[model samples]
Target chain A: MTPVLIVENLIKTYPAFRLGPVSFKVEAGSIMGFIGRNGAGKTTTLKSILNIAHPDSGSIRYFGQELPGNERAIKQRVGFAGGAVDYYPRKKIADMIAVTRSFYDNWDDEAYRKYMDIFSIDPQKSPRELSEGMKVKLNLVIALSHKAELLILDEPTSGLDPISREELLEIFTALKERGVAILFSTHITSDLDKCADHITYIKKGEIVASDTMESFITGHSIRGEGRNLEEIMLHYEKEDYREKFAE
Target chain B: MKNLLNKELRLSSHLLSYLFLFFSIMALIPGYPILVSAFFVCFGLFQTFQNGRETNDILYSALLPIDKKDVVKARYIFVCLIQIIAFILMAVLTALRMTFFANATPYANNAMMNSNPVFLAWTLLIFALFNTLFVGLFYKTAYKFGKPFIAFIVASMLTICVAEVSHHLPGLEFLNTSDRLPLQFMLMFFALVIFVFATIISCRIAQRNFDLLDL
Candidate 1:
């Protein structure tokens, strides 16, 4: 299947850290789990893909078109939900939806209302009043309502309860069934294990591994025993640490 | 562009309403034209900077499909619209004061208290200078808000102080005389040109800086 998103040699530098030369791709109808330790540049890479942060040097192709140059076109078909929902705190949920809805020509009011109803979000409530899980739900509602073909989320399940997290995974599965590609960065490995078809692991700003999720688990398992995604990630983390200490 | 402008307007609606109320109250004070003008200019500078300070807004807009250049342009356009609205309201208040109350006022002998073209020119110059400094500093610092606001406040106060002192100088005394109405009109035109040029330059600078900004 053709890839829905591709990042090649992406690099971004800050005063104290650098993320870079990283490459990955998400297929059109699969879930690509971007797993990394804290401060491992997952958010930076995601931001670069969205052009929220300008890359030092790299190429980002969305649906076969180069980014920034094709930013408007690509962004129209892609939906991004960051880790936190820091929308206008003083404005009501309805006000935010109204403003956000105006920006997209393909915004589906029915989808928005459906998700709002499912999440039990009060349109009259201020953003500041919503719980952390509700905030994530609100972001998801905004993203999915726009008829986005690709969804790029950063640490989306971080604040959710277990049940909510499970429900979110089900939502992702449903989206995948409809051929909508997903690339989400998270520290939550079990969530990935449940829904991700592909897994890409990053350690200290570099891609350590990228492959089919089953192969990743099998390769990292011990003595012909199948290991969970978290154990596999821990194994890689240990290897990374050993290499750093060895040098 | 329209969507971006709409977002700005909606986000800053509270600030706009506050300004309207403050300006309306100031208009009721005797001999308040210059005070109203100064407040109008300063309020616009302060409010626009405050809007930019909201990190939520920055993050929200970044998620949108619009270019960063459009974000900067929309903000500048919003600032201009607010300034224009405030200016018109101030002008109407000044005209009303001059028509109905200028002669009945306690400061009847004070020509400086009269609403005239010369006062309008001075107000335009002060507002232009404030915007030029505020917008230039704001974009240069990668959209930092506090520093530019404080700097503009200080700069405006100093400008107003200098203007007040210059009113007593022999060469500038004609500013208070009605016989020099043509000179006042000429000064108004020049001040407007400066305002327009400064606004355009500020927008260009902001666009360039925002393009380089990393969210």
Candidate 2:
């Protein structure tokens, strides 16, 4: 089957920074963890994929069709949550949902209620009243309610406590089991160790590696096996630092 | 588009914008620059956009299943809708002043911009200028609104000044006369045309700028 998403030769530029010609694929029914340090272009890549940030030149395709020509239709199948539910901060959660629901023909009210219950959300409360974790959950609830086949979440687990992060990872695993593809960006590699099937590692605006998680760890580990994600990441980063020092 | 418009109303709207609709009542007051009512009404709409920037409304809308151009279109439509509502209110009050209170000493002796079609025409022009300058400039960054808003204030104040000064011109006094119905109606028609044309152009510019925006 065709992958759920494909990005090819993606390029975006700023006066002091550049991201691209990046390329990656997200398969159906799998969890892809996008790992990058801060300002490493992970959010830019995600935003470009979602067309929130215009790419300088590239093609992003969803289910084998170009996104530019089929943005509305493709977006229908792709749900994106960039951090928490912070917009319309004074509006009740239900009121915000009422607005969001109108944009999706496939919006599932039952699913929304289910997530709300699972997340222990009070629909009458405004975003300002929610904790960061609760805000992220609310954002996730809306993304999932539209019956999206693919989810692009930027730092969805950031700002959560350990248990909340684990809980979010569990939700990602559950979504994967239900055939929902997910691409989430985070610097927290330990979270990836727990749940990610695939890892797309980005550094300095380029993909350093993209492969199955187990193979990635095995290939990068000191003894060629058994090292955790955090260790391997630290090892590689230190190696880069040492190389720069040598230079 | 309807879905986007609904989103704009429900999520992007501010209570202050609705409350500012009451500013249209200022048109009924004697000896005042009636065009100031139009300015306040536009200011009200500006509040929504200001609040939108503060709340990251564009990013929120961008996340929705709509085209970026559609987001711009929806906002333009919302702004136009508010302007139309305020215009209707001004029209009604102008009619009230012309008929029920036409001979009232206060209005007849008022040396300021009086309630008339010419006044209404000027009001529409103010809306047109605000929408054009404000929306167009705002889209250039799609985040920082200060420059756009400042540009709008300057343009709108200039429009108001010219409008207030027009009736005092030697032969242009008819603009202040409610009795010159045909000329006043003609002026209103041309103003309507300018308003519609300018707003459409503004929307097009905003759409282009927003499409290029990274946020």
Candidate 3:
């Protein structure tokens, strides 16, 4: 079977930075973790694959076809969630469902209702009234409501509490069990530990490593000490981030 | 193309039709002929522009399996649809005012508010046609060059003014004056034919832009 998502030498150029010379692939029915620091091109690659950001070079194929800009057939099979999924600030969750359902053929009302119940979401609350975790959950509920074959998640778990994140992980695990593919990119490593089968790690617009998640955790160690992941990984990345944040 | 038009309609809250209707009422009031017409054209374009910004989730839209041509086609159709409805309502209102203005109100027949129906119809048609034409061009241009928002609005306004002005020029009055069925029918038919051909060419141009679009 063809891979669900594939990018080859994708390049996005700007005067200050370039996002690629990057290639990666994710097979159907598997979860791939895209690991990179902030501004390390994780979102850029996602944007290129989805045709949100036009690539200066290279190609992205989704399920064996070229990703067309603003095409409906490719969008039909793909579900996307990110901070970019935000909507009218005053819109209620119920209003969101009512509006979004008309856009996609795959919208499952039953599934959407179920997810809302699972999250205990207030149907009447405006989007702005929701906590950050609730907003993320709301985003996921809409993405999952449609029977999308591939879910492209960018920092999906960033705002959730541990319990909510665990719930999301369980949902991802269930989606994988159903043979859906997932491309999840985040700064959080623990989120990848649960469901990711593949890993694509990038640094400064280049893919430094791509492999099975199991291998990455088992074989990699920086500093050869019991230093926490944040510290050890920072050293390996060879960048001092201390001054960017106050002690 | 039809499907995308339907999608744009839904995403924009089905407001263009209502906007056309609401602004048409302004025309029949007969106190502000040119003001009413300009209001409808300017406000309609502005509202449509806002709708574009609101529904501008192009990346999410790209997930669909359709081609870039169809995507651009749908957008152009939406712009045209909005302009057409606005022009039609404005034309009818102007005609009705010229017919019934004496019975309506104190301000009805004042030269400031009065207009010849034939002339009004032609002007409205041209304005509607060229306004849509400009939208197709500007949408593609705006996305491609990342032009500032204010500049895009200015360009659209300039085009609307030009198309309306073309209808009012001296020699063009013959096309506007025919009251006989065959002459009137032929004129309207030819205008529509030209409008449609222009739309098709505009669609093609927009599609080419989408093909190379940086977004």
Leading candidate by TM-score:
2
DockQ of each: 0.65, 0.75, 0.30
**Residues B1-215, model 2: lDDT tens digits:** 99888878888888888999999999988888889999899889988888898777988888777788889999999999999999999999999999999999999999898989999999989999888888878888888778888888898898889988989999999999877899999999999999999999989989998988888
Write candidate 3's Cα lDDT for A13-106 as tens digits.
8888888799889899999999878889998888778775688889788888887543467777888777545554455567656767766788
Specify the CAPRI tier of model 2: medium
Cα interface RMSD of each candidate: 1.4, 1.4, 3.7
* lDDT tens per residue, model 3, B14-69: 35545654655555443343534544554555555554555443543444445656
Error of 3 at B177 (Å): 8.9
**RMSD for each model, in Å, please?**
3.2, 2.2, 4.8
Candidate lDDT scores, in order, read 0.76, 0.88, 0.66
> How many angstroms is residue B134 displaced in model 2 relative to the true structure, after the best TM-score fit?
0.4
lDDT of 2 by residue, A147-231 (tens): 8999998998888898888888898899999999999899998888888899998888988888998788878775753387777
lDDT of 1 by residue, A1-247 (tens): 6688989999888889888788989998899999998899999899888887888999999898888688877877898776675678778889888889988878999999998998899999987898776777788788889989999989989978898888888988998998989998999998998999999989889887788888877776754434987776676565566788899
TM-score of each: 0.91, 0.95, 0.78
For candidate 2, the per-residue lDDT at B173 reads: 94
Sliding window of 10 residues with minimal summed lDDT for model 3 chain A: A223-232
